[model samples]
Target chain A: MGTQLDPEYVRTLRSDFAVAHKLLSDRCLYESAKWSAEALNGLPEDEVDDPEILIPDELKQLDQMSSSERRQYMLAKACFDCREYDRAARILEHCTSSKCCFLKWYARYISGEKKREEDSEVILGPLDGDATINKQVILIIDEIEEHFRTVAAAVYDPFLLYLYGVALIKHKCDKLAFEPLTRAVNIYPFNWAAWQELGRCVQNVDQLPFVLSQIPPTHVMSKMFEVSTSQELFQSTESVFATLAQLENIFPSFLYLKIQRAMLCYHALEYDDSAKLFDHVVREDPHRLDDMDMYSNVLYVTE
Target chain B: MGTQLDPEYVRTLRSDFAVAHKLLSDRCLYESAKWSAEALNGLPEDEVDDPEILIPDELKQLDQMSSSERRQYMLAKACFDCREYDRAARILEHCTSSKCCFLKWYARYISGEKKREEDSEVILGPLDGDATINKQVILIIDEIEEHFRTVAAAVYDPFLLYLYGVALIKHKCDKLAFEPLTRAVNIYPFNWAAWQELGRCVQNVDQLPFVLSQIPPTHVMSKMFEVSTSQELFQSTESVFATLAQLENIFPSFLYLKIQRAMLCYHALEYDDSAKLFDHVVREDPHRLDDMDMYSNVLYVTE
Candidate 1:
């Protein structure tokens, strides 16, 4: 017979279950499932049937099972919930649902309690904006958005609105993006990602050209930029200017759009207009003029 | 000689001031200070004195200042608020007062709104945890902690406790760091940094040796490690175990401490004890045995 487990060890085992409950309460279902499975694995056989000892969330609802239950999604989610991300990714690959596809991508990106080797791997590379998976997700989301746009109810859904806005901005259709993202942020100010993306969409007026000019010899960003820099992204410089000007009505303090308009003028060789705009940009922050270099470039061109 | 600023330009100026006010209201003082300074720099001579235009937070309170008060700290903070990090870093170097030392360290770390040239630099190296300045700052913080520990009131101060705890952990005195950190986290649950440091301290029972062994020949971490693997850092392993055991009484579910204990035993060649501990660990989470490599090594050694 197995020697009785140390009481502290048993308490720790139970606590993992409690931690899972807390995670579940916070909607981190995958982590919760992992901890629950841990608790079960470590449970003393004598206490196995005790509800208070290790009562799972759904165990109480076991009597209410319906016959037509399609549980593959649930099983896949459970696998994810248990921190079996590799397995979850495999399960998601076979699933045709858009959520599953997103989950497949998500499983690859989001990590569990990061241990040493994984952390060292993180330390071996650059950390910012490496969410390259977002691009593919954006494409998937774009397809979803197109399908939803046809539905009357979808226009009112904030999540769908956020997705649509994100997709548009990713595709360099920022003019079409502003309304939905603004609306999404209005509905939920807590979306730091949406706020950041909205800020970018508003800032970048000629994204297609900018992306092309900025694409490194070796980039680790989204493939969206590699295949697509369509001139169609910019309807016309004047049209872009007009739309940006219209946006300034809502965000009058957004200096980025002002600079974009200046650059557009500069590119068109409207030296007087460009000079006026550059002067205003320099005037705004006379100290450490982040725009001073640009203004100098304008001067070089005009001279 | 300069023509009166265009009406639209003046309107944008006013709007920027309004934006600064909103940022200030949200307690984003740095961004607000920056925007305010921008508006001030942009203002026409007539509008420059207009209190309605870009009055920074302290402008109304300026009259209350004592005659001996120098405003270098305020000016430095203003520079920081404006996101002129490099300039702020330069300015901070000349300020020798210990009070300003923390501010100097802070300025170097919190970057300005990241622009283009810097984006490529991040991709060229590991992106995050480049807090290499932690080594230099640890010495400064050590001095601060030493002074604070003598003051009766300092123990009650959460910030002081946090600083002390952080200094201790960073200096590899993690064993002795538990008291202040535990107190700090007890006082403030939202101190994610404190919690993280606390977790690290608890987990790293034998960090110096582990780090020495784990250091990849071509690692990109700070040169501080290569310089400072001194022998005095390690005390008795039994003492560390005893202290950890004491702590686990309060934090019974500290799996990290448990793993640390198991590893310590494994290192000491107490294979029977380690095997039992490792069994519990594997039983706790069968999937993604983050310590599988070590566990296998232990098995090989034991067999």
Candidate 2:
């Protein structure tokens, strides 16, 4: 009783499905996910507004992997995409020999979070290592460093070097920390975490000039090193003012810089300027108890 | 040598771990996960840009769920959060009598993507109505409808209603689809998927007046329905022209509206206007072969 409206309509419908299937089968997960979502919503031709799908389900057919490996790979990548590096590392650790070199390295690297924390504490925690703590941390650090030298030698990932540098720094080998940290930043100038560690690894006043040259003064973390290390090196206020002046130009609104300048003002006997800067810093960051202690010390002397 | 940096500071360190353990033991997965990550990274007070933890490793602690139920709950919730709704449903399907009612309803409702697709095809696919196709699709639809009516009767979740409306639409019970969809849009107007499907369900020529009153003409979706339903209602070009004029003001760059306008022009025997509009559409969406046949018909008339 009913006639077809267009002679080629059925062929056109089949043609549409051909295009849709091709889009879904594409190996690139992000691209395939986009088209598959559009087709699934019955809007085959239009780009759907896609803020809903946050993590791209990366469970596409991977080459030459067992079922467990594939699941771990997908889960690890999903975790990494979600910024759960530690969980990703955990999944990869459980995977029965990950074929992916990056996966193998990343799993070991990030799962070292607990070890890294303990190692840092032994080096920087209270300075009373008690012999046993240092021995335990050093043994673990040695194993990690040896693994990096052997297993990660073939691949040149900046993250691995970042970990290596962090381990060395926590081992109190600041001179050895310098090499990997330098290579890391040279490879990837924007690794904020690596740069933060690099800020703390400079050995003394002489090495500060070299590290400063390597790291441009414009970086906030670079400025952070000067403030943090001044106390570490017990540098005289007069000796550090030249460097602090350059940091001041770059970080005018920096709270730590204001406090650093206040400390310098206190040391230089500029009581009024020191009082004003300390008052400003406290108002800005009241919970910075270290700054409050410094403020009290300044007030006591100035009054 | 540094004399342990005060006995209290060492105890404070141990106390911090105690607090962390207490938090993790509290069965609040999100908060516990946060502290664990913070402790792991030595970033005690900072929000780390975490890129490796997924699913909060929620299987570790569930209040009273049996092991299988706990696993399924974690997998299902993770999948849902990741927008893998179909997968979530499958996991939830295997879950042994989940105590959480919300989880049960959602798993069953949304897991029906494949069934819904097949159901929609039986209703709207090729008007053949093969006996097996109708029986299977109707069976699934009946089950979904009955479940919604009884089990989800008291709940006012917009997503649950959205599922109900979607099932009705796929079954070609557009009149029944209207109630759930109307409530769906009422509860959440920005449900674009529901709003788009709602444009297709108005019954007949006579019902347009009532639906227009129910949904204001100023609403973009209501305007969209006018264009979509013009052919179905056998609306005269004159009747819809006023509505199209209003729609043009709202959606000036809408391709479907342009094609609808072109079709109306062709029916009205305004060959010149039809040709111009179809030509514009083809240029904008150069590969729209569906419009090509219409373009050919318009060209033949115009020439």
Candidate 3:
């Protein structure tokens, strides 16, 4: 155990790590889109990070509810929260609130994925996890794709827009993913998930400048997006480095910053310098496994 | 099957629903804290909504790695991401990056939870899940409390600070939690999760003013926090309504805004008006399960 610290001491450490994390991670995901498929493949099944729904205790009093209202919103929500997506969706079939609308379709979307999972297991047995081989998944994806496309158009909700883009991409309509994803980022630029989806729509380094032009250049997210895209596309190394340096002013001693720097050195083919940076990163964060593959390559090439 | 809609249609409807959702959900959670314990209890175990870590595909090529540098970051990360918390923590034992430090301790904290879960199963058989009954959990919480207290002092990382506050609260040192939570909200006001946590530490109506004073007054999140705490404490109904009205200018037709208004009506004994608003909500979102209990109450009281 260490010395007992005062609560007052920690109160002074005030910085928006949420925004910082979003800016960094969105860019990282953008950069990873071109270079890393595994990371993208391994995301949690539910993409929407919805805030936990809180019901008032006054409402949950068992004796208070009349028998007729048994088929109520909380019932459906309880099912949804318990991961009973189909049941939740069923209960929410006629509800009209935007939250209900979003949840209904979202629950359906998840149920579709769960269906696909079960189908894949049945079809592939030991090899069943692959969605490509599971023909049943295509039908589920197509249905969800349709559901999202319809609702996304009507609601224009950022989360729905982001999901629409993802659905289009999943349905192999990568070309169609660009518009909704772009709209999502423009409307809610703070959502790294939307930005990540939009970043995936870009085909090459040549497409990046046009994509960058579409986003708000002055916005920090746009700037972060540019940096991540440039890093992935292996272009504008100097500019990207400068932007990273600027970010460093805000996020000093940030682990990802060091990794980004090391990556920049690697891209420049300054293998010795890159190796030094990697060595430093290793020393600083021995538990970090995020960029070790690059570190290994640097060592291999130098050796 | 739905009609094939053009992506151009959704492209035309660009509004920042993320901001809308945040404002609404944060308020709902605040209201829930004071009235509903079960809703709070049902939250997912790991609370920080982190962006998925994306490693470049180029970095993951297996043939490239030489044997010596095999004990790298990727291995530890793989374990961590796979939920092998103890193994990941073991691998990252000496790592020095802030991310590594955070992960190492987070892994320990989770492992402690896992241990508690197992202990609960063993001691209680059927009754083991209740943390209060488990003496072993106290030790785990105390250890984590010590670790967070020490690191939170040095790092000043917002996530760490948030966790420190949470740990302190969990350790039943509620008074000590206030300062760190306040710092967390002031620094990264955008995180509803932080606001939710801070709101939890507030014990009464009198403490609300001082807590409000500590936060940036003009910030939207501060306003949201104020509305939430006010609603939970059932104080400042008129002012809270005014704030919600102002919020409505930005998030017009948002479900939660409607819910908040209806809730205000319910609080003010405007039961008839509240019932009508809820009726509208039901008509619009028949599938919605959130806040149905309250809706049920209005019906019961009216009947």
Please, what is the whole-model Cα lDDT of each candidate in the order they appear?
A: 0.45, 0.51, 0.55
Better of 1 and 3 by DockQ: 1
Would you give me the overall lDDT of model 3?
A: 0.55
Candidate with better lDDT, 2 vs 3? 3
Which 10-residue window in model 3 chain B sums to the lowest lDDT? B10-19
Fraction of the true interface contacts (Cα pairs closer than 8 Å across chains) found in each model: 0.03, 0.00, 0.00
Better of 2 and 3 by TM-score: 3
The DockQ-based CAPRI class assigned to model 2 is: incorrect
Candidate 2 Cα deviation (angstroms), residue A147: 36
lDDT of model 2 at residue B48? 22
lDDT of 3 by residue, B160-258 (tens): 566567666666778888888888666556555667789888889888888888998877557767877777677646678878765554335446557
User: Candidate 1 on A1-303: residue-level lDDT in tens?
Assistant: 334446565445344344333323212223223223322322443332322334344332211222111122333344454466655555445544333444554454343223223434344355323322233445445555655556565334433455567566655678787777666555433233444455566344454454334323222111212221121232335545655454343234334445656666766668778888877755643444544566788888778
The true-versus-predicted C-alpha distance at residue B102 of model 1, in Å, is 7.4
Q: What overall lDDT, based on C-alpha atoms, would model 2 receive against the true structure?
A: 0.51
Candidate 1 residues lying further than 4 Å off, grouped into runs, are A1-252, A271-303, B1-104, B107-157, B160-253, B272-303
Which residue pairs clash within candidate 2? A83-B50, A83-B51, A83-B52, A84-B51, A84-B52, A84-B53, A85-B51, A85-B52, A85-B53
The DockQ assigned to candidate 2 is 0.01
User: Over the stretch B1-303, how does candidate 2's per-residue lDDT look in tens digits?
Assistant: 112234343234323333333322222122223332222222122222222222223222223354334434543443444455554555455443313223544445544543445555446456334322323335445645655566544444444465566667766788888887777656544334555566677656777676666654465445656665774455746668877765554345545667778888887878899889988876754533434577788888788
